[model samples]
Target: MSNEAMQVRALRGRVVTPDHIIDDGAVVLSGSHIAWVGTADQAARAGFGDAVEQAQTAPEGGYLLPGLVDVHCHGGGGESFPNAETAEQAMVSVLEHRRFGTTSLVASCVTAAPDVLRARTRVLAGLCEDGELAGIHFEGPFVSVERCGAQDPTYIIDPDAALTRELIELGGGHVVTMTIAPEKPGITGDDGVNAALIEGGALPSFGHT
Candidate 1:
């Protein structure tokens, strides 16, 4: 058997799965993956009674759910991803969110000057390449100013294809997604900014109006 299948660890709690919830459920972890899941009693009766590597149980009234994915998190731990000057500072938010059960996150950047956005994307891209962050998200210079809740309206403008391509190239294949306002002026057709994003393998997600 593979090493992963040979080693077993278990967690018991109020397990929450996609299909249903087990009030007193158990999950068996084999190496890094979940090997089995069911009620606590079922686990005890189903071959897991043998010597296992480790076991954990939740506190009374605690629940066990899958790690969360935050798609648009700007910051945590008093550090802002868009405002971070260095990778270490940016990682502060990454680690902080992970500590709270967010296992997957995208570092989102807000509207900023072209140079500022490029510099920050470089930092976040490095993090993505190093596996510290899932990817980078540009929340825009391509969005509508009237609906840009927290973004700097001063930096907001019509989508520019050249700038779009530049940011993606700088990200080095780690530009997983970006936000844009489809209704924003000059953002449609062949020369549009959204098309540039697609050609660069980044998802042109419509958001922030």
Candidate 2:
């Protein structure tokens, strides 16, 4: 192995996985990727004995897990994605979440006028392009008023496939999902909002139900 690849590191802790948790586990990391994950003993058997020997032990009873993915976050650190007019402003929320282990986050926009939505999309899309944001999520503008909850009712409108397409284009392919009411018109069929989203490489998130 190259000297760089041989420079492996390990972390010993209660490793949490999808199926179960290992109380005495070790995670071997080679550079930026995880090289191995198993019980401490298994790590040694897997030829990671040196890594395990030099592993940094976690806090007593502490758990080690993967970074979180937050798909519906509006803002943090006193910054709201929906109101951010500049990329710097939106980055505040992104960095705040990243500081807490949320490595991937989707910036969500609330119900707003078409112009406002477009502006926010431009700002957020830039961050996505720069690898700061996972994607963009529009929370409203095509949802039911009765269940709008935090969405602004005044800007709510009937589902418009054309508008959806326009927003997706403005997102520069970084649009991940848009929250839409399933009961709304123009939400299904071939030329509907759902179809537009899917065609444009995005998804419809049923919300404000």
Candidate 3:
């Protein structure tokens, strides 16, 4: 094996996996990727003696798990994604979540004017391009006022397929989903919001009642 591949590090903790938890486990890292995972004793037996020797031990009772993915996040750290006008402003929220193990996030926007949506999309798309965001999610502008929840009722309107397409294009292919109301007109049919979202490589998240 190459010297680069031999450079490894390990961490000891209670590792959480999909099937079960390892009470006394070690995760070996080779470069940026996880090279191996098993019990602490197994790490040395599996030809990772050097890694185990240099392993960082987690606090007692601490659990090591995979980073989280938040699909519908507005903001954090006293910053709001919907109102963030600059990339730096938006990054404040991203970093806040990342500090707490949310490595992937989709910035969500509430009901707003078409112009506001356009502007926010532009800013968020830039973050997506830079790999700081996973995708974008629109929570309104085509939802029920009675069930709007936190959505701005003044900006709630009938679904517009054209507008959906426009926002998707603005997202530069990082538009993951848009919240919509099933009862709203232009939500179904061939040329409606649902069709437009699917065609644009996005999904319709039925919400707001």
Candidate 4:
């Protein structure tokens, strides 16, 4: 038999499924999909044509929550997302977050030399071809220096179309959300640039506050 079918996982305690939760719920997986879920006491009684006996003996567990998705996390486990100097470094941070139940995430750049940002983010975007890196969060280069927090002031600048496009390409064309300061005026907060980013498939999130 295939390894997936041979293995069995029974998480019995507080089971939280996408729809609902069962107090003493249990989920039995015959493979990747959940084969069964119900109260532990009713597991064997409900009847499994061939696996009744085995299901009855599956161990009881603690809280079971399917992996998590953190859309706005800056970093975790001592790793800083904005500090990733290379694609590998960014991946390291991603893996760290995954190990701790963050099934999904976005990289938040803390501001740096445009060239460096492009180089690093492009690699990250390319890596996302494998579905690891979700997207890039540009939190600088267009942010108000007056509100700079954990970002390099030297790299801050007004947001523009050319630079924005360049960064998107650098990120392998995978810009998801960017934190921009729309109140900064001029090209720093141009609507055209925002529209281009949106059309490019990258979501824009305004944040000066």
Candidate closest to the true structure, highest TM-score: 3
- Higher TM-score: candidate 1 or 3? 3
The global C-alpha lDDT for each of the candidates, from Candidate 1 onward, is 0.87, 0.93, 0.93, 0.70
- Per-residue alpha-carbon lDDT of model 4 for 1-209, expressed as tens digits? 89977676665567777888777766677777777877777877755434533434423555667778777666666666666666676777888888777887777776778777777676667657778877777776777788777667888887677787777776766788777777765433345567667767788777753
Cα-based TM-score, every candidate: 0.88, 0.86, 0.92, 0.76
Residue pairs whose backbone atoms clash in candidate 3: none
lDDT assessment of candidate 3? 0.93
Candidate 1 local distance difference test against the native: 0.87
Which regions in candidate 1 have their CA more than 4 angstroms from the true location?
Answer: 1-6, 51-54
For model 4, the superposed segments whose C-alpha errors exceed 4 Å read 1-10, 17-21, 28-36, 41-61, 186-191
Runs in model 3 deviating more than 4 A are 1-7
User: Which digits, one per residue and each the tens of the lDDT, describe model 2 over residues 1-209?
Assistant: 77777678999999998899999999999977899999998876799998898999988988889989998999999999999999989999998999888999999999999999999999999999999999999998999999999888999999999999999999999999999998887898899999999999998889898
Candidate 3 per-residue lDDT over residues 89-168, each given as its tens digit: 99999999998999999999989999999999999999999999999999989999999898889999989999999999
Residue pairs that clash (backbone atoms under 3 angstroms), model 2: none
TM-score of 3: 0.92
> What does candidate 1's lDDT look like per residue over 1-209, in tens digits?
78966678888889999999999788888777788888877765677754222458789998889989988889999999899989999999999999889988989999999999999998999999998888889999889888898888999988899999999999999887888999976688899988898899989999888
Tell me each candidate's RMSD, in Å, in order: 2.3, 2.5, 2.0, 4.0
Q: Ranking under lDDT, best-scoring first?
A: 3, 2, 1, 4
Give the higher-lDDT candidate: 2 or 4.
2
Candidate 2, poorest ten consecutive residues by summed lDDT = 1-10
After superposing all C-alphas onto the true structure, candidate 3 shows an RMSD in angstroms of: 2.0
